[model samples]
Every structure is written in structure tokens, then in C-alpha cells.
Target: MDEHGLVSREFTHRYVLPEDTLPRSVSSTLSPDGVLTITAPKKPSPSAPNERIVPIAVQGGPTPLPVQHEP
Candidate 1:
């Protein structure tokens, strides 16, 4: 809705990502000329990490395995 109470334009789009994306990495930009660009970097593969940190759980509790480095 515009200030003059009129519908100037509307847009809708559906996109499918080829791979999982990194957390909080999705972004979109609209140029002055009305060009829209979307960017999302793919998530690192399971084998991408060269090093990982193995957390020590307390009394058999759950532990989170986190990657420390990427190769």
C-alpha cells in the first residue's frame, strides 16, 4: 500500500537452493533499477573440516561436536 492508498506494484518469487546454506548467510539486494539479487553460500560438506573439537560430556550427557577448521 502506498501513501496515496494505491497498489503501485507487487512481486512474488519462489526459489529452490541447490544445497544447504550456512546459517544466517542468506541475503538479498535490490538495485535502484529494480534488479533483485539473492545470495546464499552453500553449507560446508561433512568432510570439509580438517579438524574438530570433541566436547567432553558430564556423566554421559550429550556432547556437541564442532568443526575447528576447514580445508
Candidate 2:
């Protein structure tokens, strides 16, 4: 409050979401009690490949990383 018993304020906000999230599904709402809500639905996942092979190149020494596959 400066003078005349008045008040002023300003603010900014940002939100980050996953790349797979459906942009058109995003929604937001603000309640009367000063509460804010945001929601978005994810895009359907693509079908997985039955099998895949990845080639690894060896350097001067044995790779310190282990390879694993997930279902």
C-alpha cells in the first residue's frame, strides 16, 4: 500500500508438461476460494515393437554401462 490506503500487486506463473500430453485436453479452473486447478489427459501410447536389437560400440576399455530391456 502506497498512500490513500490502496494496494497493488502483480505476479507471473508458468507450467511445464510432458511432450506426450494432449494439448487439446488441457483444462484449468479457479475456485471462488482462491484455489487453482489444472488438468490434462495424456495421449494414447503407440503399440510396442515385438523385438529390437541395438548395437553397442566398444571403446578402448570395457563399457561401464549395462544394457537392459523393459517390457
Supply the global lDDT for candidate 2. Answer: 0.82
Report the poorest 10 consecutive residues by lDDT, candidate 2.
45-54
Candidate 1 lDDT tens digits, 1-71: 87889866777888777758864788989898889899889887676457777897668666679969978
Residue range with the least summed lDDT across 10 consecutive positions in model 1:
44-53
Residue 15 CA error for candidate 2 (Å)?
A: 1.8
Steric clash pairs (candidate 2): none
Mind giving the per-residue lDDT tens digits that candidate 2 earns over 1-71? 77799876566797788898998889989797767798988998876788566798768976578878898
As a whole number from 0 to 100, the lDDT of residue 64 in candidate 1 is 72
In model 1, the runs with Cα more than 4 Å from the true position are 1-7, 48-71
Best by lDDT: 2
Cα error, candidate 2, residue 56 (Å):
44
